[model samples]
Target chain A: MRTDAAPSLAAPWRKRRTTHYRRAEAITGVLMASPWIIGFLVFVVGPMIYSLYLSMTRWDLFTPPRWIGLENYQQLLFNDPTFFQSLKITTIYAFVGVPLQVALGLVLATLLNQKIRFLSFFRSVYYLPSVIGGISVAIMFRWIFGTQFGLINSALRVIGIEGPSWLGDPNWVIVSFILMSLWGSGSSMLINLGALQNIPTELYEAADVDGAGTLAKFFRITIPMMTPVIFFNMVIGIIHALQEFVLPFVMTGGGPADASLFLVLYLYRNAFQFFQMGYASAIAWLLFFYILVLTLLIVRSSRAWVYYEGAIRGR
Target chain B: MTTLPANRSFNQSSGQLKQFLIYAVLITGAVVVAIPFAWTLSTSLKTPQQVFTFPPVWIPDPIAWWNYPEALSSQPFGRWFLNSLVIVLVSTFGTVASCSMVAFAFARLRWPGRDLCFLILLGTMMLPDQVTIIPTFILFRELGWVNTFLPLIVPAFFARNAFYVFLLRQFFMTIPLEMDDAARLDGASHFQVYLHIILPMSKPALAVAALMFAQFKWNEFLGPLIFLNRSELYTVALGLRTFVGQEYGTDWHLMMAANIVFMIPLILIFFFAQKYFIQGVVISGVKG
Candidate 1:
């Protein structure tokens, strides 16, 4: 919303002055923006181009990078089982975990949206887990999912039921992470809450006058109105879940025969652990491609599902 | 008339039942959510024997306050805490200052390619950090900046955070243009106007950005995990991870103690500055 100093047509000198002012403003603007511009060049664009090049080459940290055209990509696609395994694992995690997280968030948000006492208290209690960093949460969950003395098992034992070793079992490892993911859905819940509040109560009131039941009003009005925010949360959540590294790294170490081996964790192992810079770069690019394609697909699908209140009002 | 009154009474009773049900569900969910934290705190104060007891001791009879000091002493937690403080503070300060400046340029200034630059910035946000991790590491290694805080700290000074910049720009747009025009008329330079008029007026938004950035930096793991190999240079997150890894058949009590210690500052920040946190989340959510 910047206003330019337009050159005055009537006064020749004023026009010159205006041009000078405009020039100065532009210079100042560039000066102010230079930090980010320089950063983008040195950090973002430069690394991206170099990484694309690196993806085709073979390099360990000690050796000079050997350029081999599309070998890394070919090996990753046709040769490596781990590559496909990591891809499948990450896909399932993001797709399954994000929807569950979004649904739970919506449910919690809907519950809290009622005219209630201690609204902030309930919100804070529920949202508290999300801000606690990943490592600590992972650490906490390692204990909570512990086989013998863990929180869940101990609770189960009281009812005479034995609990599974969550992190130890290959099948249960992903399930454990999924459960852990639920704890942090508070962030999405906050987002869902914000969307819920913005929804006009008049819609519900109008539904009430038409003799609609609670479920009908909710599904018909609230869910439709909330679709945009849900779409946003899903896109953000899926992208984030796809990059799940820290929890698996710290807790499971992508263990139980790579059951929890996420794409980024595998990428990290290749890059840092094995020091295969070139191959790791290939994995990174593949992960990026998946995220890009998934995000695009979601954005494309949003037209059918997402509801903008303004669109209806404008009509 | 009699039937109408009966129907009104039934509606009133049903409304009351609905309110009760809502409360019941909310309270039950809240308790379930809070249990892990309560378990952690309970474990932090328990003896090792108590930690493994069946039916799991919910409360310790004699609380072990010594666990905090004992766990902290086991690792170079003091050094790690200081390292984290330095990184989080320096980077957070840089993020707030640089982001606000860049945001001002985007929100208020007229320039060639300004809109394009902003669009590029938004585009970069979608590009996952993993995409550039390899080459960025190589670049840092070439510069001999690997195993140092430079990789973590330098980016903030250059407005590497597109989200913060976007947030601040959204805020800056809300400040009336008349204020800037008035400041300019009074012979204030663009920088002067940003410093005096915009920055001061944007305290709330600035505070939101700073708090969120600090939280992110303090919790950051991946950067330190990859860059800093030296134990002495470990941040709290990395240090805690190492602490957990160092011992086999991990001491649950000590681990819980360490976890709680790591979490206290963030918890305190949340309780005190929750309004900003919620506002930041809501703004990012609703707008993005």
Candidate 2:
């Protein structure tokens, strides 16, 4: 991927000409990167600063923002019960949903990794729902999880068992979200499959030579080899879990006493529905801070578990 | 390398059992994943009465295909479809054009501050959209760009998504630099090399980016929900939301019909360009 040959435009005087050529390349690089650089400033950095300011104040769209000096944050942290409820719901959803997605995704990937006929067909079927947008899936699942005539209840009734209202019951609302999360485990499954395929056969052969059984070979070889990919999935999946919005919004509307009210859902309500832009900004920042802290914790924990093939020296 | 005949036979029997078990689990998983689509399709064709029928009609008795026209006509879905098409196509074009260019810079060109800039871009990916939504909305509102598609479309032109840029950059890095050397020897400028050589040769990666952008824009709910207030300007996703949010009695059959209609384009794209979708997911996952 490296370019070693100097273009003809570079003169024979190696010192001065090399400097000139380097400058030209640098200018081109900056020109090429300018779009993203400018975009990062305007879209990401600028709004981030303004949001920090907005988080400190109380403002509706019509009036000028009144500076509240951390009142929004203080109120949210110490005074608001709904804020704590939203946090509790979102925390449970993310912590539970992420691990479930990772584990189920790995299981599905392992099943698919077996040498089989119609491999692509099976993979496609599993991965299909993930490509579909969140809104449509949420709507479809709303019907599937409905109280009286939903698919699950109807099926449960045939087996002479009763089923609880999935979306309508507060106790079962998070369970419904977890089930939905499992349905879209395709991305992690694909990643795990790719990692599984890339594991060298020699490792398994060595394990076979040692009279290692399937379970032993799996734990000693396959899992250790797959830790890097697993770590990647966990981090990405946790962030995604924390940011869930559309599904709860479309399916349950955070109903059954706000049991499914994810952090982002609460933020949306504050910003748009309630027109509490400043307080909404505070919630957004809190969510951002939470995600950052969680990501750092995962990265720190990965050092103990995640293995790098190239970097490892010995058992 | 030789094994006893009895040992080989024993291994073969065990392998057969393992294969059967794998098939069992895979089939169960496939069926579980697929049932929702099957149910949605069946419900789309069912009458209101059959939708709630106990013992669950897997197939609608009368096959009420009229639900499609009925649901679609009840809303200005035609207008919404057109609106969605405009937003998706233009935004996809912007994403491909800008992200590819930015990716080319990051992947191929040498510059001071380049690594720092790329790191900053990666950091932005970790920042949730909620952090910026309020201020970005206010920015657009102040520009009087509310109730318009500009808020959604213009950001793509600026290469707003770092993930796309990273994906394109990863793909770009795999292209051998000898090709660029030949173009450079021919007196091609950096832009010329990007335009004439890289873009033409990297069709698959570009297709991945464009398809991803199109899918994302078509199904986008939050942006459209916030910005576009007029029903006439509603994207298909927003239109479907309105259909489901009607105040009167919920019409399950028609709502399912509309959802199936909304999903048609995505399904078609999946059937035709399935490999790109899978490849994109694999690539995005591998390095991250």
Error of 2 at A174 (Å): 0.5
True contacts kept of each: 0.76, 0.75
Which residue pairs clash in candidate 1?
A: none
TM-score of 2: 0.95
Docking class of 2: medium
Per-candidate interface C-alpha RMSD? 5.2, 4.9
Model 1 residue B74 CA deviation (Å) reads: 0.7
In model 1, state the lDDT of residue A233. 93
Error of 1 at A103 (Å): 1.3
Question: Weakest 10 consecutive residues, lDDT, candidate 1 chain A?
Answer: A1-10
Write down the TM-score of every candidate. Answer: 0.95, 0.95
Best model number under lDDT: 1
